[model samples]
Target: MSLRRFTDELWSDIEPIYAEILEHPFLRGLTDGSLPRTAFRHFVEQDSLYLRDYARALALCGARAPETESVQAFLSDAAGAIAAEQEMLAGFGEELGEEPLSQEVLPTTRAYTSYLLAAAYGGSYAEAVAAVLPCYWIYARVGEQLLAKSSPDPLYARWIAVYGDESFQEIVRRVVALTDELAEQVSPAERQRMRERFTVASRYEWMFWNAAWIGERWPV
Candidate 1:
């Protein structure tokens, strides 16, 4: 079976969670333009922080990949991620007239980034790829869903367009293909580890959106 099929099967186990995410008030508000600016601002800031670390993790994956093609693909993804972060910053700056660098990283953002970095630095290539897949995969899914019922909010619409673009989907397809190829070579035990990592990261994707919805902070 292809890695995409395996991922789809795994996603079926968590499809309910993704459904919940789609129903999240924050996402709903975002799609409808009812989300408070404060909430969206918080999300943009935290995501900017998240993407920096995410790009680093992708770079680490590139360095660890065995094949030249895999290395090129991962490195390209790292660059693309960074570019997306920059675009987000610029878009938010124009919309909110605030600097992204001025915001502090929230606890949820920190936890998510730390987990991804640990996986990238310490886990096998397969594990690292699985760990990062949800961000790409889930965002694309969310984007397409939102785009289908697109909001009149230009800010939200612009955000949706980025993830829903065919280019982004192509990137995800390449990564999924790479993951399946790697899955074929690894031992059963290692494959299990990859699945575990994928599930954890998928949960983190949910938590990230929930945190923004709640405007979560370090309570200490």
Candidate 2:
């Protein structure tokens, strides 16, 4: 099967989870402009935390990449992730008067980043790529959907625009293509492990948003 088909099949397995994410009150509120500012603020702050580690993970993937082109793609993605984080910080400043450093990392933020970083550091190269794919792919898909709805809130609209931008979508497509390419190089067992990593990361994406909606914090 072509890599696109493999990617599509992987997504099919997680389509129900994606559906839940779309129907989530946080996302619904975001599209309708009824989401409380506090929740969005929390999400922005946690995402700021998540992005730094995410960039590092991408860098790790770059380091592990066997080909020059793959290395360049991973590095470019790392740079883009860092840039996105800065943009998120600026958005928070404009919308909530929150400084990136002023926000503490939430538990979910820590857990999700830890999971990704671990995968990047310890998993095979294909698995590392797989671990990171959901973040890129899911946001692109959600952005397109949100753009079609077109939020009335400028903040929400700007957020959607960032993800829906053709440039960012291209990055997502590149990563998906990379994952499919890497999938072909690995053995069947390794491919299964890659899928497992993808699923875990995908689930983490859902949890990250849900955590923001609830304003998750340590019980202790």
Candidate 3:
């Protein structure tokens, strides 16, 4: 389906979740780029683990999925996509004399892992596919705002640079389009249920960052 149609379907699934995200006091700062650099950095560190698991889970999905060709194709294409999302992070990290990629996964990453695992198991491949859309879409959206945030530390600049770059928008479009296609299952009611699931998932999306931002004193 076209991107607009995809957006229509995706909107049903994610709008409620997006609404919850908007209500988050912690993420509210993100609208205008007021989040603390320290918190944001910690969040990025946590994402390293999240991305690793995402790739792994996709790999599992590709392996077990009935149409291994299609599943493998998506996973293979997504392979190394996020890690190379932007080249600025390493430069910024180097400015801080830090390494961008780390070898370990943290507890914060579990939120994303649990999310994908649940969708992959509880829902169909299409649904699991639908559930994964926001990660890419929201990041691209958040990254644009973050890149524009004033006076970012060079380190953070590295991270935000990737999100703001227009090149990643295509990926977002692809994922969103893919989700809408996946949503074309049975009925509007089922689609609405998917939206509800998406909203619940979006809440966790907020908590993942809220936890990192406030370090476990995360507010609901």
RMSD, candidate 3, Å: 4.7
Determine the backbone clash count of candidate 1: 0
lDDT by residue for model 2 (31-74), tens: 99999988888888889889999999999999999899989988
Q: On residues 1-220, what C-alpha lDDT tens digit does candidate 1 reach at each position?
A: 5335666665776687788889889889988889888788888888988999999999999999989988998899899889978888887767876454446888889999999999999999899999999898888889889889887898888887888889898998888777877888899899889888988888899899889888898899
Best by lDDT: 2
- Per-candidate Cα lDDT values, in order, are 0.86, 0.87, 0.61
In candidate 3, which residue pairs clash? Answer: 13-195
Please state every model's RMSD to the true fold in angstroms: 1.9, 1.7, 4.7
Between the candidate structures 2 and 3, which one is better when assessed by TM-score? 2
Minimal lDDT window, size 10, model 3? 85-94
Best candidate according to TM-score: 2
Q: Model 2, 148: alpha-carbon shift in Å?
A: 0.1
CA deviation > 4 Å runs, candidate 1: 1-4, 98-101
Give candidate 3's TM-score.
0.71
